[model samples]
Target: MNSALGSRQAAAAVVLLFSYNGLVIGAYAASIPSLTARFGLAPWQLSTLFVCMGLAAIASMQVSGRLSDRIGARRVSLAMIPILVAAILTIGLAPSLPMLFVAGILLGLGNGGIDVAMNAIGVQVEQHRPKPIMSFFHGMWSVGNLAGASMLVLLAPLFAPDPQPAVATTTSVAAVLGVVAFVVAWRITPETAVVTHTDSSGTRTPIPASAYLLGLMAIGFGLGEGTANDWSGLHVTQIAGVDPTTGALGYTCVVGFMVVIRLLGDQLVARFGRRAVTVFGGACSGVGYLVTALGSGLPVLLVGWSLVGLGIGMIAPQVYAVAGHTAGGRGLAVVVTFGYATFLISPALIGSLVATLGIQKTMFVPALLLFGLVFAARIMPGREDDVAPSAEAEASWTEPA
Candidate 1:
């Protein structure tokens, strides 16, 4: 029971760190339009910069997740703080288009690496904790998103009179906050980490190919999230005829709703198993997109975006929960990282699809995927405790952590 308590504490710490990370990442996104206008880059050129960030993040996911097992998430996460702070600072100082792109790459790598380590350790910590904790833990990301976006939104006007002022102000404040969160969260991690092992009898396990299914699920959710993150604001402005500043409110609404939903998500999942939750959740997301694509007026856009938030709220966390149950030891981390990699890839892929089709139409791509994911939800293995030892034996086959 103490071990379980420790695990929950560990997971909570991971969530705090990521909440800070989310704040920093979200600030960067809000600042992008400013960055684009300041640099005078075309829309396609700006999109390419985001693609660079995605590719860098995807590349680092596996490396960081595997590194966590050997050195520990605490150490890797601690080391990442300085790099992240430095990246954010550099972003503020970026004076050229090329420099901004470079910042994106560095920021993406740091964000990805920290994400993998924290999630890997988080699930391991949740193993001993009572009830479904992963959803709440993952929900912290949304909390971070809310905090980060709120910070940007509040500061947006203050910086608004001038682009230079907005960029510098938002980035600097965000960097300081990020550093403080990292330091505090790092201090809370257990000194004697439980260290995950794959085999019940052995010390380590490798993530199986079957776990790619988890990544596939992630690709679906990632699309929804990516659409929200990248396109919600655009959708409001273009479709609902809102002012650019007011348009961002749509994303703000989504982020705020997601944060609340995720905070309460554990209770929801406990009441309804992951299978039912995921399928219905996907349907909710599909409806959200469909509404945004089809509906007119501010009220309709807000409603659609809000539904989008609710739908995706549990999807990513469930993937982590399933990975934790299916893969043991550091294998959990590896599988989570693989999912992050998909997260990295899907947005750009979706963006290209959007470019080819159009943003409003392109969203249907992820919506369709999530629509299909409703059916795929059945493939996710059942509860960790339900599997018999024979099942465990099959699950425990050869793999290095």
Candidate 2:
């Protein structure tokens, strides 16, 4: 096992990397209204663009898992920083819709690669620790969301006169943060602690049945998360009849609770166990969407969104953690890929619904998806007997600070 101090440093590096990734997404999210106005795109066109990104992400994730397994996650993760930074810069400089599509592809590729790599590292960290700490790492992601949102709130007024400057400035910040993330990535230990399934002849085995169910849960959770990240601000403005600034606040409220709950998630999972937490959290998220759909005022809508954050915050991390135990890096990739595939369809689905049924009614889609978790939660592996004893012992490796 790694020394206590080395383990702590590795954990910090992983959390910081997660935060940087969230900052990139959050900053782009805050700029969506500006992007819409600048491009003069209908909701469907925007959805199509998201589909482009999602397709690219899926492709990249398919390969990233194998690449991480071969090269070590630390190197693969550090290498993605440049690609991510370049993509962010390109998105800022894009002058046409076609250019935006090209930028989105690059962004998706970088994001997909980094996502698998970091989760692999996260699994490594979890194996050395005695408790569930994946949620705490995810909490840093929420913190990044808050930081990015706050930045937009402060900077939006200064750049409202022109969309280019707003995007340029935001992406510039992302670039700077990416540089910091690269530095942190360098500090991560090169070795991974991963559990692999092997037969007597030392051939790798197929993914377990439990992983498939976990992937399904991830897909449902992804729909809710994707909606919140992509459409929550618009929902507040279009459905609740609020100003853009106020709408941004509603999005902020959702992420704020997400940060709080995820920060405390380890204790919750330890106390209640994985199955109970998954079911309860899913139910809360369903209720939150219902409240938002029925809300007549901004205050009610914001409250509902807050609940949405609280409820959905820990699901992904828990799912990833379980995947980590079951299949290590490959499992993380498979589950995340399945989950993120919702992004491929969700934007277009929601956009079509918004065009016809309206945003309020369309919210039911995510609500239904989240509610599905009630049954799906049954598929997750229990804490006490999930990982094989030999795999656990073999997977532990020293990670230098």
Candidate 3:
């Protein structure tokens, strides 16, 4: 569908869309403990759930990127909304383990598609802007994550102590937010992704070498982000020996830090350049895991996770912006697929590792992996990349009229 929205309005609509995606994920993040209890899930079982979700999400990415290019990204993104809602609801309310697997697959599939489609939309929107705004768009996603997790935390006191009610309420909130996001996207999303000549010409723009490096960087960021959103609360309960309610604060702190840095990320990129930011963020988060590993108390845990959040907040938005600016959908697809593979897979991998290594020790894995960001930083884009598109990218797309 064609969009009639002016620039600011279209930007707002995409922001809401990105936020809604994060909101759904946040609801899942908030309900992790409750879902664990509601299903009497063992660590391995949780691993299985994540594996199912990760695999399906990975599968969806393989197709969704090309699909978005074939059709309008707006339509593809809007189509995934209800699927996402149903998946999140099922996750919070599934009666059996098998059904939970179903929920995981559904959620993964829906999320994977929307993730690619929305980024496509975001990149297209950024194409028209004078300054880098991709990071701000992603920052709103962090805000949405904070909102989702905080909503559950706040509502828990009002409900009975049952985990199921919290799960239900969290999903209900997601459902409402999902509806609002769907309406906004349907009415005014800019659908700016190129869909005509490139599709027919059989043109497949080769992804730049740098985009691959960015994808490599994205993996560590994805793993770190997954850990914060999925298991920070549990990390508090297990390592810090806090009550589960207080553990909720762990999730909030990490994502909350993410919100601050992401909102400021574009400016930092403008000032320091993506390579400097990537290297610094990598070092900070790697050390954060070390700090987390050493700390047995709440302050240390929160501080460590806060560092992780801040560092990671700087990584993904820049990666997305660079890839989207230089590579278009296909390159972005390669990057997104690699990036989010770690995003969802980290949860499953950690669930498995946490069983053997324990949560405290498992922190080292991301720490080690994230140090790769420093190595990958060599390929990060300069300040010029923020404002310039690759000639290859210019050939592959025609901005929708």
Among all candidates shown, the one with the greatest TM-score: 2
Best by lDDT: 3
Ranking by lDDT: 3, 2, 1
**What are the runs in model 3 whose C-alpha is more than 4 Å off?**
1-6, 42-44, 92-98, 195-203, 227-252, 290-303, 344-365, 392-395
TM-score attained by model 2: 0.86
Q: Write the per-residue lDDT of candidate 2 for residues 133-180, one digit (tens) a residue.
A: 788888988788667756766876797767668677888888888887
lDDT of 3 by residue, 1-401 (tens): 45533388778877988888888888897788888887789988987887788788877876777677776567778888989989988887788889888988999999888888888778777767766677788999877876888888888887877768877888987887788778767777876656432433677445568768878878888888888777888998888887999988887788778788888787877777767887888898888888887789899898998898888888887787777677665666778888877775676688899999888998998899888787887667666676556554532565556
Candidate 3 lDDT at 340 equals 71
TM-scores of the models, in the order given: 0.82, 0.86, 0.84
Instruction: Report the Cα RMSD per candidate.
Output: 4.2, 3.6, 3.5
What lDDT tens digits, residue by residue, belong to model 1 across residues 224-295?
787797789988998888799999988887777777777787777677766677777888988888888778
lDDT of each: 0.70, 0.77, 0.79
The window of 10 residues in a row where model 2 has the poorest summed lDDT is 386-395
Clashing pairs in 3: none
lDDT of 1 at 366: 69
Report the Cα lDDT for residue 65, model 3: 72
